[model samples]
Target: MSYIETTMKKLQRSSPGQPEFYQATEEILQSLRPLIDKHPQYLQQNIIERMVEPERQIMFRVVWHDDEGKVHVNKGYRVQFSSTLGPYKGGIRFHPSVNASTIKFLGFEQIFKNALTGLSLGGGKGGSDFDPKNRSEQEIMRFCQAFMTELHRHIGATVDVPAGDIGVGKREIGYMFGQYKRLNGNFEGVLTGKGLNWGGSLVRSEATGYGLVYFTENMLQAHDDSLDGKRCLVSGAGNVAIHTIEKLYQLGALPVSCSDSTGTLYHEKGIDLILVRELKEQRRSSLIDYLESHSDAKFTPIDQYPKDGHAVWRIKADAAFPCATQNELTLADAKALSENGINCIVEGANMPCTADAQAHIIATGMHYGPAKAANAGGVATSQLEMAQNASMIQWSFTEVDKRLQEIMKDIYQRCSETAIEFHQPCNLAFGANIAGFRKVADAMLEQGLV
Candidate 1:
């Protein structure tokens, strides 16, 4: 059997029922075939085998008390996939959908994403099946403390640092950090996405969204196009999607849509950035509330989405940003977008597109950006936060944002150049997987077998 085939079968057996993790591994392994063929040394050393298996897999039960004095139990996971380049780094998500398979997939993708940033960071991901929506403040705080009580032992500033994702945000981070501080009795940079007054770097929250746009702009410019005056569809109303819409407006693009768990919202003229931020970031309300302000906007409930596709992709637009969640977009969605003349599709979330959907996007000549490379802004800025914390000095917002832009540009240049080198010019996803793998693989080779 082929090396890729053999490795995949083994992974399937070892990680049974983890379709998401297997899908992520298969994607990277398939892309790495070219690089592997060029470097037989990697095979000889069994690098692929070592790289797929995580250095550590942490599974813990978090028991917390809610407002009504009810006990709750949730599964928590921390998959420290690799530390070949530097310290283990990734985000801590809090959502009902979080599971070992999801975390594993996210952690595996992190290895390549962190590598693409040209930063001294490794790959890891942790989360729980705890849903933060509609929970009382007291309940949320207690849950954060309970979760941190167990998690604090596994992480450290220089060993494994985690930021926030999805349901886990500043509120949750604040609670967790406070608990860690009370428990450890020492102030350290063990986490990113901290509050402004507390060790957190500026522009960190907005980094991922802005970085997505920056990368998208870079790709468009490379193809002699730009986002100026384009109608864009952005999925998700979280930090990534909200910030993506914000930056799109700043770049003169009309972002027409943003969605959440409830439904998708589309404003044909343009999305009101301020209102979205208010509803999602502040009010914690649903996208359905948007129609109260913009009476003309359209709201499509989740059930009302096309049977074969998604609501967000059905809208006619020049570009699409899938910033929602894993496998949210299917091949039918890609086809629908292509039919509507949407060409530029940049992933703002980890593994947002299914394997087949991603293939269709590339096959139809769309300017596609994979999640590992395109959605790397959040982690990149987290590293910057780590640097600021380690140095005991915080840079100005403009300074931090300038660094973010430069990093995004470098990532684009590297991915693009590597794609050209491999004779698949503009295939950024393939280039990204190859470039990221080579960096980590080479480092692992030099560091010797662990």
Candidate 2:
């Protein structure tokens, strides 16, 4: 067996029951055969073995009380996965799905995703099983305060910084920042995704979605195609999907569908962005609420979805963007997309596609943008926010967006060029994994064993 295979088997044995972490590790290791052949020094140094392990793992208890005076307790975690490149940087996801395996998988993915940005940021991820949905503002504030009480000790501007993910957003960041400031008695860039009046960067909210579209545009342009006049289907109505639809409209693509946890909403003419934002962002309601205003749109609940696939993927479209949760697009969903004639697929969410589904899509010769490369925009802009905070200079929206565009373009070029160099042209998933792994592996080798 090869060095990568041997190390992967060992990882699976050691980290048993962590299917998500194992899945991510296997995907990257499988794509790294060429790198292993080219650099025996990496194997000699045991880089793969060390790289699979985190530098530190922190778990704590978060206790808070709701407005009704009911006390609650939840587990919190922060996995400082790697610091080969720079300070540990990633987002803190707040949802019931948060766990050791979930955090480890996300931290592991962030290591490569941050590397692909060509930015000076390492990898880490943290969160709790605290679901923010349906929680009152006061309850959320109490939870954030308690969560930051412990997190504040482990993070700083130049040490380890966290932004937001899933259920964590501007409100959560604000509450956490307030607590951090109270504990430290100082204002600093300890976290990104802050309110603009404080230290957040412009376009930070729109970065991931816009970057996904930007990367897709680059991919299409490379193939003599464009997003103009393309029919697109997007899943999730969160910040990522919302901005993705906005950018699609800007690029002359018609986004016809968006979904939430409850169901998928399909509008044949085009998605009403204003209504979607109102339903999701402002009201924190389901897609079913969207139909209250626009009765012409169709809403298919989760139970009504096809037996083998999601309703979003069942809809015919020129491109598909899965911006929901991990492993959302199954192999059956990929077949449905291919049969429905999806020309390209880009992931706005981390690891939204299953390995089998990803392979099936690639085998069909569709343009596929892996999450590590496509979703790096959000973290890239977060780093930009850190830069602004350090300098005490807030840039305008146009300036920050221009820089984001340049960075996305540069990342796309690097992935494309690396794929060609490695004789895996147009195989972006393989190219991204190889490209990201090489940089971190070389850095680890130079720094020696920790």
Candidate 3:
């Protein structure tokens, strides 16, 4: 067997039951075949083995009380994946699905994602399996405090600084920040996604979505096309999906569909961004609430979805952005999208597409943007927040956004140029994996064994 294959077997044995982490690592290793052949130095240094291992993995039990005086227990995790390039940077997700497997995958993906940004960031991820969906504010605040009470010890502004993901947001970050301050008695930029009045940076909330669209525009502009009048399919009703819809509208594209955990929404007339913000950001209701406004729109619940694939990808569109969770788009979904002539598939969520799905899209010559490169905007903006915090300053919305746009363009160039260099032009997944890995691997080699 090949070295990459051997490494995969060893990882399976070492990190058992971590399929998501393995999937992510496998994708990168498989894509690096060409690069490994070109430069055997990385292999000689055994960078693959060292790179896959985390610097530190902390798991703790969180005990918090609800408003009703009932105690709840949840498992908290913080995986410091890497600090080779700079400080560890990623997000802390609060969802029922969080575990070592999920966080490891996210942190592994973040290592390359941060590298693609060309920023001084390493990789880390933390979270708890505390479902925050219907919890009261008091309960959430209590839980956030408990989670951070332990997480604060392993993280700092110069060490591992986490941002928000999935169920964790501004309010959660605020509670955690307060707890961190009370414990350490030192106020610092230990976390991103803080409230605007605090040490937060402008354009941070909209960075990932705006950056995804900017990357897509760069991809299209390279081929003499644009997002003008293009129809889009966006999945997920969270921050990334919501902002992606907003920026797609700004770029003259009609984001016709968006999905939540419960169902999928398809409005041929275009999604109402204002209503989406109200339902998701404010009310936190299901997409079914949207049909009350437009009877012509279609809603597909999870139970009624096609057995082969998700209902969202079956719709016809010019481009598709799977901004939901990992492994959302399967091979069937990719085939359905291709049948509908959806030529561009840019991932806004980490490892959103299945291996077969991603391979199929790229093999079909689709203008594909991998999540590590496409979704690096959020983390890049987080680094900008770090800079602002260290300097005790913040930039205006326009200024931060301009820099974000430029960064997206630069990332697109790096991926596309690397693809051409490797004789795999337009296969951005390969390009991104190679480019991101090379940077981290080189840094790891120079930094010596840790």
Tens-digit lDDT track for model 2 on 394-434? 99999999999998888888899889999989999988998
Residue runs of model 2 more than 4 Å from their true location after superposition: none
In model 2, where is the ten-residue run with the lowest total lDDT? 2-11
Model 3 segments more than 4 A misplaced: none
Instruction: Report the C-alpha displacement of residue 202, candidate 1, in angstroms.
Output: 0.6
lDDT of 3 by residue, 129-202 (tens): 99998999989999999998888889899998999999988899999999999999989999999998989999
Regions more than 4 Å wrong, model 1: none
Q: Return the TM-score for candidate 3, rounded to 2 decimals.
A: 0.99
How do all models score by TM-score? Answer: 0.99, 0.99, 0.99
lDDT rank, highest first? 3, 1, 2
Encode model 1's per-residue lDDT on 202-239: one tens digit a residue. 99999999999999999999989999999999999999
Q: Candidate 2, clashing residue pairs?
A: none
Candidate 2: TM-score? 0.99
Clashes of each: 0, 0, 0
